[model samples]
Target: MRLAKYLSHCGVCSRRQASRLIEAAEVTVNGHPANHIDHVTEADHILVSGQLVEGPAPKQLYMYHKPVGIDCKLRPDDPSSLSHYLPPGERVYPIGRLDKDSHGLLLLTNDGELCNRLIHPKHHQEKEYRVVVDRPFDAQFCDRMSAGVPVDGVITQACRVEPVAADTFTIVLRQGLNRQIRKMARYCGYRVVDLYRVRIANLKLDPQVLPAGHFQPIAMTELKLEEEEK
Candidate 1:
């Protein structure tokens, strides 16, 4: 595999970050600084910043109940980064992001391929959210949002929306755009006061069991991604 890909498989860093590390001479293969496009094999000795690089780790997945204030992006200087809540020494990253202001079920995994599959727009994975807008809205508002509203210069995909109350509703979307629910509501003259994801594909967030700021190991079988193509 290419050195960057190998590094990503090893749970060291992302492929892009691996390239930056290689450019900075932080990685060595067989005692020589690694080239950006170098291929790696079992026989090659690799070191990343004096730490030996080993074979890829077994894949791991977790269901985390993300809190509103936590940032999804991992940054060394950010104390509230998602990394801080994860188990020490596990290099898993979130499959998709929930903006800092929104919170709910977020998946973290070490399997890069699975991450790509879950987040890719072509997959059409269902994501359900419970939302509360600042003011009461009528059936027309729900109809407008369900039909598809313009957000970020593109019409959002038709989605299922059910009103639970004048100010609250549930929606299930097949596409994930940045702050999509908030932007969509804004376009329809409503402001989202609260947004919480309740489900992703077959995985559902049970607040009583896994409350905010807590996480638990989840089996890949629960996701049922392998059955999608069958």
Candidate 2:
């Protein structure tokens, strides 16, 4: 395969971005600067920015209950990062992100294609959250949220909003904007005190089985994800 395509398969970046990296003279093949966008066979050695770009690592997918205060960045050196919580030497990235303040089921994996599929808005993957707010929850709050509310100049898409208590509700969103649920609540004149994502796509967080800061390997078939490496 072409070097850029191989880089994409390594989860480095898309082929276009890989080409840009190559153009910048950041890629090397067999310890020498690579000048051509050439094909790389199994016998050839490739590197990008000093990092080896070999065959894809073993594909792994984990259901992680990210506790509050841990940021969803793949920084192994940062003690507060989600990567710090994983088993040692297991390099993976979050499929999508949960802000530092939020907690719950986050999918982490080495499979870039699966991550792209799940995070792409076109898939309409459902993400459900349990939210606690400062104001008393009312039908109007549910209606406005269900109908869609303006957040950062863009109105949110229609979603399922079910009241769970006087001050809490369960929300299901097909779209993920930045701090989406929190922003939506603030737009509706409420302040979120706590936000917990309980589900993503077809998987739900079973707290009793997988508690906070804990993780478990889940079969790709459980997520209905194909095993294609790239």
Which structure among the candidates has the greatest lDDT? 1
Per-model TM-score versus the true fold: 0.86, 0.84
CA lDDT of every candidate: 0.88, 0.82
Query: lDDT tens digits, residues 6-77, model 2?
Result: 775676654555687799999988877776558887678888878877677777789998899998865667
Candidate 2 off by > 4 Å: 1-5, 11-44, 225-230
Candidate 2 weakest ten by summed lDDT: 221-230
Q: How many residue pairs clash in model 1?
A: 0
RMSD of 1: 2.9
Per-residue error (Å), model 2, residue 50 = 2.4
- Scored by TM-score, the top model is 1
Q: Look at candidate 1 and give me any clashing residue pairs.
A: none
